[model samples]
Target: MANRTSRDVLLRGLWVLGQGIREQPGLFTVGVGGSVVFGLLTIASAYVVGAIVGEVVVPSIESGRVETGLLGAGAAALLAVSVVKVVGIFGRRLGAGFMQYRLQASYRRRVTRRYLDLPMSWHQRHPTGTLLSNANSDVEATWFPVAPLPFAVGTVVMLVTAIAALFATDWVLALVGLAVFPALFALNVVYSRRMAPRQVRAQQLRAEVSGIAHESFDGALVVKTMGREAQETARFAGRAVELRDALISVGRLRGLFDPLLETLPSLGTLAVLLVGAARLRQGAVSVADLVSVAFLFTVLAFPVRAIGWVLAELPRSVAGWDRVRHVLTATGEMPYGDTELPAAATPASLVFDRVWFSYRPPVGEPAAPATADQSVDPTAVGVPGANTALPPVLRDVSFTVPAGRTVALVGPTGAGKSTIAALAARLVDPTAGRVVLDDVELPRLTAGSLARTVSLVAQVPFAFDDTVRANVTLDRPGLTDEVAWSALRLAEADGFVAALDDGLDTVVGERGTTLSGGQRQRLTLARALAGQPRLLVLDDATSAVDPRVEAAILAALRNSEIATSILIVAYRRATIALADEVVYLDQGRVVDHGTHQELLARCPGYNDLVTAYEQAEAERERTRSGTGTGDSGGGDPGGGPARAAEVVA
Candidate 1:
C-alpha cells in the first residue's frame, strides 16, 4: 500500500510536469534544442582532438615539418565549435530559467486563488504558516525539477550521441563505457529512496518554523507583556534547529551520492584504456581510434552527471508537489452564489432561522465539514479548546433586526455572541439553518454583494502600514475627504485624526502599532463606516474605548444620518443602552430578549449577568481610585450599573 501511494505521488508529479511542458512547449524546445546543439558540439570537440593527434601532431613529429594550413584548419574548426557552444549554452540556461520562472508564477497564482476561495473552516484547519509556504517554498520546491528537466533531455541526447561515437571509433571500448550508465542509474535510485523521506520531513519542518515565527511576531505584544520573550526565543530556536538538522541529513545523503557519481566515470575511463591497449596490440584499433574512444568517455562524464542531477531532485519535487496538491484538492470550499444583489439598493435585514452551528478543532488533513448530525450542542461543548466532539455554539436560535435598527448581543464570555455576529456577516454559514439579509439567504448572495451590503468590524482592529486616509478608505476609489471626514466623525475618530502630524495622510505603522488600542478600534470602525454598508456588524468594536468616547460614538451611530442596520456585540451598559433591543444569552442559547428594562424585569439570567458586570466595574473603579488615577469622565464608572440593577430587581 505504501509503495502504491508513493508511486501514485510520483505519477501525479509527472502529470503536473507534463502539463507545465505543454503550457510552455516553446521554452522546452529551446532548452532541448540547445542540448542537441551541445551534443553535436561534444562530438565535434572529440573528433577535432582526434584529428589533431592523428592527422597533425603525430605526422608533424614523425616528419619534423609543421604544416601551417593543417594547424590553421584545426584551430578554425575548434573556434567555430566554441562559438556554436556559446549559443547552445545560452539556449539551455535561458530556456530552463524562463520555464522555472513561469512555473513558479503560475502555481503561485493558483494556490493564492485556492486560498481565497476556500471557506473559513478550511482556513481554520490549516495554519497560516503552512498556507504561506504552500504559495512560496512548497511551490518553489515542486517546480525545482523544471530547471533540470530540459537539461536532462539534453543529457539523454548527449548519451546517445556519445554511444554512437564510441562504437564508430571502436566497438570494443564502447561496450566498456556503456557499463557505467547502468551503475550510475542503480546508484541514483538507491540514493533517492534514502533521501526522499528526509526531504519531506525537511519541507514540513520549514513550514513549522515559518508558522512559529509568524505566531510569535503576531503575538509580540502578548509575549512582551507576559515577559515570555526568552521562552518564545527558545521555542523558535528549537524548531529552527530541527529544520537545520533535517537539511543536514539530506545534505549528508547527497554528499555520499556525489562522490560515487564522480568516481564511476573515471573507472569507466580506466576500463576503456586497459581494453584499448589490448586492442591496439592485437591490431584491432589505431591510435587515433583509441584516442577518440577515450575522449568520448571524458565527454560522456558530464552528461552522466547531468542525468544524476535531475534524478537527485526528483524525490523533493514530488514530495513538495504532493503537499501543494493536497491544498488545491482540499474539500469544504463554500459553494459561492451567483446571485448578485440588485444594484439599485441592498435591503439589509439580518435574521437567524432555527440556526444551529458547531466548530471542532481540526485533527488532520481531509477534515469533514460541519454537518447536522455531527453538530455539537453549545450547552455541552464546554469551553472550546482541543476537545473535538463539542456542542454547538448556537442552538435553535432565531431572531431578526429590521433595517435601520440596532440589536445588541448580550451574553456571558462564551455564550456564542461572536458566533451570532459571524453568522450575521456570513463569515461562516450556519450548520443547520440560514442567516437571511434583505429576504435573501446570505449564502445566496454573491461575495461582492455580501461585502458591499454587510460589514463586520472586529474588536482588535488591523491596519496596514499606510496613511490614515488610505486605511480609512481601504484603497476604495471615489472616497474623498468629504466621505472620510463624515465617517470619522461618526466613529468619533476625527479628534485623533486632526491631532496627527499629517492629518488624514499620517502613516499608521504595521497593524496600527503607532496608534493606541482605542485609536485602532475607532479607525477600524471608521473604515467600516466609510464603506457606508447597509448592515453593520460590530463584535465588541468599542470595548477598547473609554466609556465616554464609546458613548459618544454610539450616540453618533444612533443619530447619524446613515440608515444602516447595526448588530453589535456589547457588554458595557452604555453600549447596550444605545441599542433599541437587547438579546440576552446564557451558555449558547438566547435566554430572553427584549428591551433592556423588559428583560431586566423578567429574565433572571439577563439581570444577573448585568449585575455581574456592575460589580466588576465597581471593583475596577475602586482599584483605579486607590491607584490615584481615577478618571470618572472616561466610563460611567459604577453609576449606571447599580441604578440599572435596581430597575431590574
Candidate 2:
C-alpha cells in the first residue's frame, strides 16, 4: 500500500508537469529543442576526443613526428563544439526561466481575480494571510520543477544514445551500461518517495507561519495596547520553528541522496573502464571505441543528475499545485446577470421584502442556537448552505428608504444592523426573499449597475496608502479634483484636507495612519460620496467623528443637491432625529417604525433605548467639557434642549 501511494504521488506530480507543458507548449518546445542540441553535441564531443586520441595523437607519437594540420583540425573541432554547446545552454536557460515566471505570474493573476469574484461570505471563511500565501509562495512552488525539466528530458535522450553507442561498440560494455543506469533510476525513485511527504509538510507549514505572522503584525496595535506582545511573539515563533524544522527535514533528505546520485555515475564510468580493458585484450573493440564509451560515462555524471533534480522537486510542485487548485476550483462564486439598471440622477429607493438571513456553520461544525444580539466572531464565518441550523439573524424583516429620504436603523448592538446594511448594498444576498433597489432585484442587476447605484461605507474606515485625491477618487475616471473637493466639503472634511502640506497630493500613509480617527472616517465618507451613489448605506460609518460633526454631515447629505437615499445604522439620538423616519429593531425584528417623536411617544422599547443613548451621550459630553479637552463648541454640553424637544414632541 505504501509503495502504491508513493507511485500515485509521483504520477500526480508528472501530471502537473504535463499540464504546464500543455499550457505553454511553444516555450516548452523551444527549451527542449535547445537541450537536445546540447545533448547531441555532448555525445559528439566525447567521440571527437576519442578520435583525436586514437588517430592524431597516437599515430603522431608512434611515428615520432608532429602533424600540425591534423592537430589544428582536432583543436578546431573541440572549440566549435564548445561554442555550439554554450549557445544551446543559453537558449535552454532562457526558455526555462521565461516559461516558469510567466506561468507563476499568470496563475497569480487568476487566483487574485478569483478572490475578487467570490462574495464577501466566501472571503469571510478565509484568512487574508492564507490567501496571500496561495497567490505567492504556492504559485511559485507549482512551477519550481520547470527550471530543470528540459535538462532532465535532454538527459533521457543522451542516456538512450549513449547506451546504443555502447552496444554498437561492444555488447559486453552495453551490459555494464544497462546495469548502472537502472540502479541510478531506482535510487532516484526511492529518494522521491522518501522526500515527498516532507516537502508537502514544509509547504503547508510555510502557509501556517505566514498566517500567524500576518495576524500578529496586522493586530500590532492590539498586541501592544493589551501588553500581549510576548504572547503574540511566542505564537509566531512557534509556527516559525515548525516551518524551520520541516525545511530542515527536506534539506536532510536531499543531502543524503545528492552524494549517492553523484556516486552512481562515477561507478558506471569505473565499470566501463574495467570492462573496456577486458574487451581491448580480447580484440572485441578498438581503442577508439573503448575511449569513446569511457569518456561518455565520465561526462554523463552531471547530466544524469538532472533527472534526479526534477524528481526531487516533483513533491513540492505537486503540493503547490494542490493548493492552487483549491482556489481555482472553489465553489460559491457570486454570479451576476447581464441586466443593467436605467441611468438616473435621482435617488434610488431601497426595499427589503420579508428578507431573512442566517450565518451558516463552517464545514463540519454543527450549528448551535444563538440570539440575534450575540456578536459575530470573525473567524467562524461559514461556507454556504441551503438552510442553517442556527436561528436567522434577520427574520422576515421589511423596511424601505424612499427615494430622496433618510431612514435610521435603530437597534442595540448586534441586532443584525450591519448585516442589514450589507444586504442593502448587495455586499451579501439574503438567504430568503430579496433586497430590491429602484424596483429591480439586486442579484438580477449587473455588477456595474449595482456599483453605480449604491455605495456602502463600512463602520470601520479603510484608506489606501495614497494621496488624498487618490483615496477619495479611488482612481475612478471623471472624479476630478473638483468632484473630490465637493464630496469632502459635504462630509465636513475639506478644512483639514486644505491645510495639509501638499493638499490633495499628500500621501496618507498605510490605512490613513497619518490622520486622526475622525479625519479617516470623514475621508472614507467623502470617498463614498464621490461615487455619486444614488443609495448610500452607512454602517455606523461616522461613529469616530464628534457628534455635532456627525449631525452636520448627515444634514448636508440629506439636503445635498445630488439627491440620494440614505440608510444609516445610527446610535446617537441627534443623528436618529435627523432621519425622515426611524425603524426600531429588537432581536432582529422590526419593533416599530415612525417619526422620532411618534416612536418616542408610542413605543416603550424605543423610548428606553433612546433614553439610554441620551444618558450615555450626556455623560461623555460632561467628561469632555469638564476636562476642557473637547473640540471647541462641537456639541451642546448640556444635551441641547431643542434636540431633546424634537425627540420628545
Q: If scored against the real structure, what TM-score would every candidate get?
A: 0.89, 0.90
Candidate 1 lDDT over 1-649, as tens digits, reads 6556555555665676787799889999998888778877987788788888889888999999989999999899889988998898889888988988998999899999998888876687677888898899999998888887777788787877777777877777778867887787778666666766787889899889998888899876667656789999999999999999999999999899899988888888788889999999999987777777778778777766776676666677887887889888977766768887765443368888878777645546333444665455454335333135345678788888887888999988888998888888877777667788888888888888888888899866798999999999977888899899999999888977888889999998888767766677788999998988889999988765767888888888878777688998988876788899999887677788888889889988888888888777667657656756433322232323332222122
TM value for model 2: 0.90
RMSD of each: 5.7, 5.6
Worst 10 residues of 2 by lDDT: 640-649
Model 1: which ten-residue window has the lowest total lDDT? 639-648
How much lDDT does each candidate structure score?
0.79, 0.85
List clashing residue pairs in candidate 2: none
Q: Which runs in model 2 stand beyond 4 Å of their true positions? A: 59-65, 362-384, 388-391, 598-649
Top lDDT model: 2
Report the C-alpha lDDT of model 2 over 416-437, residue by residue, as the tens digit: 8999999998777877777988
